[model samples]
Target: MNFKGILLFISLGSSFILSFFLYRQWSLTNWFDALFLIGLLLIMVYCVMVLIEGQFFTAFLKSTRNFFAKVNKKDQLIRESEKRSVEPLDYRKEFPNRSSFLQVGLFFCIGSLLISSALHYLN
Candidate 1:
């Protein structure tokens, strides 16, 4: 398996193990609760991963800086000078294959929801 596939396997396994322990600790009789919680957790992680991959915060900061720069011409000049001195960092290099994370999270979430629904009806 490729590196991403291995990582995905590890993440899914860890999440299941963690949720299983949590389920036992909480004294829950139903497996549905554990699965549901795992699904939600994975989905949330996927959302965070996507946000970081997209550099949403960096864009937000740039816009905020621009707004402040417009309000003060002096500050804008200083900001321009700083920008010229600094090189733009490639943030994408830090996180590769973000779609894999999204897919894994969604798969777990949807699978859990379906299983929970089945269990609910069966019970």
Candidate 2:
């Protein structure tokens, strides 16, 4: 129930409705055109999601890396008495409740498409 979920629902639902209308109105005249339009809409959605996901993950990883890098030891210990080891970043553990919304958004898109297809078939 995040913003991405709401937006995806609206976007997918609108496209599905528009596709249905095209199918009903012009399908007989140019069935391939209707199909092509629907396919293009789906592809566009897929590409947008991919781009968003890529940018989100890339920025997330970079920030995490930078956070660790900023705290890193710049100088090595030359003397045993001055030895101080910088702790390694524990990225092996997952961030609490992080990026769950993005996955939920992806699921929302899938669910919307399935529901739209079901309704379309019923009609």
Q: Could you tell me every candidate's TM-score relative to the true structure? A: 0.57, 0.28
Which portions of model 1 miss their true places by more than 4 Å? Answer: 25-32, 59-94
Tens digits of per-residue lDDT for model 2, 1-123: 975556456654555566567666534223333433444555565555656544646657767766665555453323224664444334333333334434544454555556557667888
Best by lDDT: 1
Window of ten residues with lowest summed lDDT in model 1: 85-94
Candidate 1: lDDT of 79?
70
Q: List, residue by residue over 1-123, the lDDT tens digit for candidate 1.
A: 876587567765666576667755532234445555655666677688777767878877666666765788786688787785323444562556666666666766677678777767888
Candidate 2 local Cα displacement, residue 28, angstroms: 3.6
**Which structure among the candidates has the greatest TM-score?**
1
